[model samples]
Every structure is written in structure tokens, then in C-alpha cells.
Target: MDINKIHYAEITISAVSPKQYPDDGLPEVALAGRSNVGKSSFINAMVNRKKLARTSGKPGKTRTLNYFNIENELFFVDVPGYGYAKVSNAEQEKWGEMMNVYFSSRDELSLSILLVDLRHHPTELDVQMYDFLKYYNLPVLVVATKADKIKKSKRNKHINQVIQTLELATEDKVMVFSAETREGRDEVWNEILASTRNDSI
Candidate 1:
């Protein structure tokens, strides 16, 4: 569906618990990233909507799994961003507990999309998250955002650092993205489409 236009998408629900999630049994794509990783921007770009997902200057804005229905084809679940030190220990634990339960048990989760900053190597927390998803045997697609901020000549260097830091296998998927230029946007949609196909199979 790369060439086809994706015309419908809307926020179906903001779920704090599994019971609150949509029961339609659609294949879901779960997005995991840091607070400022431009996830909201990424989602809006993918759906071609300006503000389908809210953007905030403040970090750690998402506290629940925000589910978006994409043309009734699949669900995009945006999970809370991690590693914001300004948040209290109590809040972090709550976030942790919430995430643990959601990731550990969600079966409708067809793919996990991990966002890392393209400008820097993956952080310790990012590595842990990647491994955590791997532990669950979930297929992950690592997306490096803010590609336009860096020089083209240095792009491979940044990408390789992410690979080595995460110990990603050569076969593992990685995609560089730029919200400014919308570069790699169509390819991401194609990858999402493939994940949905795999879920159906």
C-alpha cells in the first residue's frame, strides 16, 4: 500500500489498562521511545495528520497507551516515553508497572517500533528496552529520528553506532527518518504494512 493513500486515522482510546484497550482484535503496532524522541510528530507524519497525536514541549507527556485506528486496518499503540529524570521515583515505578503488564501480556501486538535519536548512540535505557522486546519475542523495527539534523556524510556513522550499541543483528531492520523533510516516510508505511501482513499470516 506504499503508493496507495492512507486516508483514515483517529485516536480510538487512551488506555491505562488492558481492559480499556480496543477489543476489535486488530493487529497493533506499539511505539516505544524517549519523551523527546519526536514520537508524536512521527505518528502525525505517518497518518498525514497535523495533530492526530498531541505534541508537547514537556517530556514524559504520555502516561497511557494511546491507540490509533488506521483505516480500520490496524492499530498504532503509542506507549509512554522513558528516561526522563525530572519525574519522581514513584511516578517512574508506576510507569514501569504499567508498561510491564502491558508488554508482557498484549497478544494483539503485532510489532514493536523503537525510536532512538539518529544524532547519538542508543542509550543504556534504549538498549534495555530493545532487549526487553526481544525477550518477549516481539519483532522490532528500530527507527532513528532527526536524520535531517545531521550531515549526510556522517549519517552512516550514526546509524552504525546505533547498530553496535544495541548489538542489532545484521538482518535486523533500521530506518532513518526526518520529520522536516518527510524522508523515509513512505518506506515506514510499507514496513508497517508488511508487519500487518505478517500478523495476518
Candidate 2:
């Protein structure tokens, strides 16, 4: 977990279904968030690679289940971002179908790292996704991204807003993160390592 050490990371696949997933059974962590919520930037931050995950000024740029191989030990599944109105209804429905099939039954999926903007409350879709993950009984690590944009004095207020909006349980782990400053990167990796290594979470 040394940030300075070199790492092997690449886009293993842009899977659209279970058949396309790697069959080796590596524990997987899925990233979920809004269309412009910085999931890609978060991924790059975690791996200490500036462009490991593609960044876009446009929302809904990521359209498939992108699996990133991290040092050949873990898979970071970047699911398509949700809650963008610019995408067509049919396109959204297609993504919905793709996600429902994957999240509902992907056995290797060990953890879900849900991203929420620290500057605002969790949106309705965000709430629904939390409930969906809960329904599946998966352990969640909620990361409030864009932490650098907020002042330290007012951060707790925004963090509280996220917790309250999601009605996060006491055991749920939540923290502020910044891709720009790499804030919370090590802590997030610690959480991921803990969650992925433990069989019972």
C-alpha cells in the first residue's frame, strides 16, 4: 500500500454482462455515484495515477462497467454514473438494466464505495442506491468527494447533511475526500483493504 511504489493498473475490460467479467474471482469493489460526482477522479486518486480513470468535463461520459486491475490483487469496478437528464430515457433504461443485472448477482462484488458530493445533500437517486446496497447486505464505505472545495470550518455541516440524507447507520463508514489534494486517499485504501480482506463485513 505504499503510494510511491509502482503499481500495475489497467482497464481489464468494459463489461456489459456477467459473462464478460473476469472469472478468477478476485474480490471487487464497485464505485457508484451521480453523473458528475468524480468517481473516475476518485479511482485515480486511490491508485495514485493521474489518468488511470478517465476524467471528463461532461457528465455521463462513462457508459459501461469498467474494471480496473490494481496490482493484480483487486478489481475496481467503475459502474456508469446515474442521475443525468441529458442521457436519453432509453439509454438510461439500458444502463439501468445493465446495472440491475450486475449488482443483483455479481458474486465477486465484495464492497461498494459510494461517492457523494460534499457540497450538497445526497440526492434522491443517491438515497435509492444506498437502500439498494443495503438490501443486498453489502458493506458500504461512503466517500464525500470534492472535499477541497469546502472550507474546513463548514465541512462538518455538509458531512452531516450527507449522513442525514442517507440515514446512514452508526456502523457505516463515511469520510471527506479530495482528488485534488489526495485527501483521504490512504484512509480510503485502508478501508478498502480492510473491507476486501475480511470475509465477513
Candidate 3:
């Protein structure tokens, strides 16, 4: 299939309770990151469909897993990004529990894209997420978002910091991306395609 032609057809809320996932057979690629880290923008960039993922200047706006069907070939699951301010402790705890079940038991989740800000090294929350994915033995690709914000000379340094901090091996994957500039879209597609081949979704 021509990935460049891919467009977002529909986005439906899936498993608002986090207990109803892994039942859908569609291959799932999950996007995870800290709040305001540009995950929704990344999704919009990936499908070449602007505003489909509903980006907001405010953080913690998305609280549920949104599933988007792409040309009937794969599913893009937008997991709510974590660590937002002004969120109640009870709400945060609930979100944490919901995520725990999703990551641990969702059999249909094939690949997880961990989105981090390219201009800054991964934050503590980002590090925890990387460790969590590793502990689960899941396939993950670190996405350094907003690549255009950093200078060319500084990009490698930031990327190296993320790699070393996560303790990722040379073979482990990471991609630099900018949603506004539409960079790294094709590479992200390639990674998603690779995940689909494993038949986990």
C-alpha cells in the first residue's frame, strides 16, 4: 500500500474503561508520552490528516484511548499522555491503574511509540515509561518529537542522551520527528509496518 496516501477515516473511543481492549483484532500501534509532548500532533502527521487527532495547547485533555482505523490495514491507538498539572491525585491514580492493565494485558497491542521532546532529554516520566515498556518485553520505538525545534548540530546530542538514559541498545529503535514540518512520517510508517508483520495485533 502507498503509505503517503494514507488518511484518517474515523476515530472512535475504545475501551473508555480500559477493560475492553485486546478484543479487537485490528493491529494496534499505540502512541504514548507525557502530556503536552505532541503525541496527537504526531498522529496527525503520520496519517497526513491535519486536526484528526485534536491537538490542544492545554495538557491532559485526552483521557481515553482513541482508536483510528487506517485503510483497514492497521489501528492507531492514542493512549492518553501522562503527567499533567492540576489533575487531581485520584484522577492520576485512576489513569495509572488504567494504563497498567492496558500495557500488561492488551494482547492486540503490537507496537508502542514512546514520544519524547527532541529539544530536551527525556524527563523522569519519560524514563519511567521506557522502563515500563522494557519490563513488559514489548516492542517500542522512541520518537523524538519536534525535531525542527533543535539545531542540526544539537540533534545528535539530544538523541544520544535519550538513548543512553533509556539504556537502549544500538539495535533498539528511535526516530526524530516534527509534526508541524511533517518530517519522519515515512519512517514512522515503516516502523508500524514492521510491527504488523509480527502478528501480535
lDDT of 3 at 105: 80
Please give the CA lDDT of all the candidate structures: 0.88, 0.89, 0.82
Estimated TM-score for each candidate: 0.94, 0.95, 0.92
lDDT (10s digit) by residue, model 3, range 104-160: 888778899999998887888999988888788888999999999998898889989
Q: Model 2, residue 60: displacement in angstroms?
A: 0.8
Per-residue CA lDDT of model 2 for 13-102, tens digit only, reads: 999888898998889999999989999889888888889898998899888999999887789999989998899999998998998888
Task: Please give, for residues 2-71, the per-residue lDDT of candidate 1 as tens digits.
Answer: 3346788899899888889888888899999989999999998887788899999999989888999998
Ranking by TM-score: 2, 1, 3
Question: 1 or 2: which has the higher TM-score?
Answer: 2
Q: What is the lDDT of residue 27 in candidate 1?
A: 89
Which candidate number maximizes TM-score?
2
**Which regions of candidate 3 are displaced past 4 Å?**
198-201
Deviation in Å, model 3, residue 71 alpha carbon: 1.4
Highest-lDDT candidate: 2
| Native RMSD of candidate 1 (Å) | 2.1
